[model samples]
Target: MGRRYDRLIGSLVGTCAAFAASPAAAATAGAPHLDGAEMGLIWVVPFVAILLSIALFPLFAPEFWHHHFGKVAAACAAAFLVPFLVVHGVSLTIYEVVHVSLLEYLPFIILLLALFTVAGGIRLRGSIIGTPAVNTGFLLFGTLLASWTGTTGAAMLLIRPVIRANEWRRYKVHTIVFFIFLVANIGGSLTPLGDPPLFLGFLKGVSFFWPTQHMFLPMVVAATVLLAVYFAIDSTLFRREAPRPSDEASEETFGIDGKINILLLAGIVGAVLLSGIWKPGIAFDIYHVQLELQGLVRDVLLLLITFLSWKLTSRENREANGFSWFPIIEVGKLFAGIFLTIIPAIAILKAGTGGALGSVVSLVTNDAGEPVDTMYFWLTGLLSSFLDNAPTYLVFFNTAGGDPAALMGPFASTLLAISAGAVFMGANTYIGNAPNFMVKAIAEERGIAMPSFFGYMLWSVGILIPIFVLITFLFFH
Candidate 1:
C-alpha cells in the first residue's frame, strides 16, 4: 500500500510538471474561458470511470481494491487531469485542482474526520435482545440523532448496537438496509450538520435554521413512514424466527461509555455553527480560491477536537466499538477523486442551455423560464443518487438561481426540493453517501452479509422510490 501510494503521488507530481511546461500552458494564460458548450460527451469518461471503479471494484475485486483503492482513485484523477491539461492547458488544470482542494475537499474531509473520530470514541455499553419494538426504537432514535450528530456520526454510533442486537437473527439484512435508509441518509435532511450538501448551502449564505424550518415536514413524513414500515417487517420476521439461547444473557439496560466524547460531539456541532454565524469577512486567496477566516478557524478546531478525542478516550472504548481508521480513509481518498473529476460535470451543468447536458437544465424549467418544483425534486434526486450529493445539490441550487436570500424566501420550495432530493435520494445506493459505505463495511466486518451494489438498489427501488413519489405529490407538486 505504501509503495503504491508513493508511486501514485510521484506520477501526479510528474504529470503536473509535464503539463506546466507544455507550450499551451503559457499561450493560454489570458485566453477566454474554456466553454463547456464546446466540450464533447467524451470529456466525462474519467468521471464515469471513477464512479464505476467505486461501485464495481469492491464487489468483484475486494482484496485488490481494499489494498489499492487509493491508487485507483489517484489514477482516475490523473486520467482527468492529463487530458484536461492537454485541452485546457496547465494553468487551468492547476487552478481547478487548487480550487477543489481548498474549497471542497479539505473542509469536507476535516468534518468527516472529526465526526468519525469523536463518535468512534463513544461506545454504547449495554446490549438488548433484538425485539421488533426495540429495533424500531433504535431506528427512531438514530433518525432524530442524525440531524444533530450528522448522518455519518449517528450511523457510526448506533450501527454496532443494532448489529449486535440482531446477531442471532436469521433475517437481519433488512434491518441493516433500513438502518442505512433512515440513519445514513434520510434522517440527515433537517439540518446542515446532518449532511455535507446542506452545510455547503450554509456556507453559501443560507441561514443555519433554514433547513430546519423548510425541511421539517418532509423529514417527519419520511422518518415516520420508514419507521412504521420497519416495525411491521421486523415484527413479522420476529415471529418466524426462534429466539437465540444467548439472548437471555444480554443486558436489558442501556448506558453510554466514553462520555467525554459526547461533549466533543457537541463541540463539533458548535464549531460548524460558529463558522457559519461568526464570519468576519476576512479571507486569504490561494490560487483564486478564497479561504475564509471562520472556515480556517473551524477546520483547526475540528482537528483539535479529533486529536483530543483520540488522546482522551480509552483504547478499550474504541476496540469495543470495533473502531478503525480505514472507513474514514476510504471516504477521504475516494471523495478526493470525486471532487476532482466532478469539475467538468459541474462546469457543464453550470453552462445551462449552452452545454452538452443542456437538456437536463431544460427539464427542470418550464417554457416560461420558471423552476418546476417536481422536476427540481426528481432531477436533483436522480443525479444525486449517482453523483456525490454535495456538488449535485450545488448544481441544482445554481440552476434554481444562486441567491441565498431568494432561495430562502420566494424560491423556498425549490430550495426545499433540492435539499430533500440530495439528502433523501442518497439512500438510493450505498455509494450515495460516505457513511452508507462505512456502515456496510463495519457490518460486513461483524459477519453480517450485506447486499451487493445492485441488490441494495433493489431494496431502495422497492422501498424508497414509492416514498419519494408520495413526497413529490404531497409536497413538491
Candidate 2:
C-alpha cells in the first residue's frame, strides 16, 4: 500500500510539472489574489474529502488505511493543489505552500516531535495498581501538569503509566476516553503554554497571563466537573472488574527512570517562551514566506533537545514505556494534509460577511452589530472541533476586532468565549487537537480497544456538549 501510494504521488507530481511547463500554462504566470467571496462552495470538496478520509477510512478499510494513510493524505493535498495552481497560477500556489509549511506546519510538527520524543524517553518505574483513587490521582496530576508541559507533553508522559496501572482491568476504555477529555484537552486551557490556541493568542499580543486571568473559573469548573464524573464512572467500573491476585498486596513502590528528560521538557517550555519574548526581528524570505529568526532558533533548539533526550535515555526506558515513532509520524502526515486543505476554508472565514460563508460570520453578531458572546462560544467551538483550533481562535479573535487592548477590555467576554471555545471544544473529536490523536494512537497501541471515530464523538457529544451548554449560560451568556 505504501509503495502504491508513493507511485501515485510521483505520477501526480510528474503530471503537475509537465502541465506547468506547457506553453499555455506558462502564459498564466502571475499570481492572482483570491477572493473568498467569489469562490463557490465546491472548492471545499478536497477539504471535506480529507476530513472524511480521516474519520471513515480507518473504520471502513483498516488494513489499507493503516499502510497507505500517508498516501491518502498526500492525494488529498494534491487534489487541492492541482486545481488551485490551475486557477490561481504558480506564484500564488507556491506562496500558499510555503506559507502554510513555513508558518504553520513546520512549527506545529516540530513542537509535537520534541514533546513526544522527550516524553517517550521518561519511564515511570513503579508497581502501582489501577485502583479508582490511584487512577483519579494520575488524571488530576496530568491535568495540572498540562498547563505547564503542554497537552501533548503531559499526555505523552503520563498515558503509558495510566495504561500500565489499569492493565488488569477489563472495563478500562472509559478511563482512556476520560483521559482524552480532561488531560489531553480541557487541562490545557489555563495558560498559553497549555494549548496552541492560547499560545497563538499570546503571539498575537495577548499577555502571557491573560488566559489565566480570564479562563480560570471556567477551566476550574470544567475540570472539576470532569474529574468528579470520571471518578464516579471509574469507581463503578473498578467494582465490577474482579481483582487480580497481584491486587491483594495493595502497597506498591514508585520511582521514575529517565529523570533527566524532565529537565529537557522544561527546556522545551523555555524554548517556546524564548521565541515569544526574544524576537530579534530578523527574517529570511523563502518564496515570499518570512522565516523569523526567533522561530527558527526555537525549532533548532527543540530539535537539539529531542536529540539529547534520545541519546541520554537508555533503550530499556523507551521499551518499558512502549514508545514508538508511529504516533508522531501519523500526526505529522495527517496534519500536513489538514493544514494545506484548510487554506481556502480559512480564507472564506476571514472574508467575514463578504465571503462564501457569510451566514457563519453572521451567527456571532446580533442585528444591532453587537457581538453575541454565547454565539461566539458555540460557533468558535463547533468550528474548532473540525478545523484546527489555533487558526480558528485567530480567525474569531480578528473577527471580534483584532486589537488586544480592546479585546481584553470591552470585548473581554468575547475574547474569553473564543479562547474557551478553541481550547475546550478541541476535546469534541480526535482530530480537534494534535495531542488527542497522539493519545489515541498510544492507547490503541497498548491494546486498549479504542472506540471508532464516530463512536468517540458520541462520548464527547453526550458528555462535553451538556457541560458546554451549562458553561454557555453560566459564563459566556
Compare the candidates by lDDT and give the number of the best one: 1
Q: Give lDDT tens digits, candidate 1, residues 1-477.
A: 121111110001000111111111122234225566777777767777876776556657777887888899899889888899998998778777776676566777787778778877988867687899989999999999888877877887899889888888898999999998999888887777788788767756677789999899999998899999999999999999986885357655789988999999899888988987785877776665566788799999999999999999999889887677766667678778877876776667667778887887899989998889999999888877765566678678767766777889998999999999988998898767666766777788788899988899999999999999999999988
lDDT of 2 by residue, 232-281 (tens): 99988888998587645445478888999989988988897787777676
Q: Which candidate's TM-score is highest?
A: 1
Clashes in model 1: which pairs?
Answer: none
How many pairs of residues collide in each model?
Answer: 0, 0
- Provide the overall lDDT of each model, using Cα atoms, as 2-decimal numbers: 0.76, 0.74
Using all chains and alpha carbons, the TM-scores for the candidates as numbered come to: 0.87, 0.83
Show where candidate 1 strays beyond 4 Å.
1-34, 243-247, 251-253, 447-452
Tell me how candidate 2 scores on lDDT. 0.74
Worst 10 residues of 2 by lDDT: 9-18
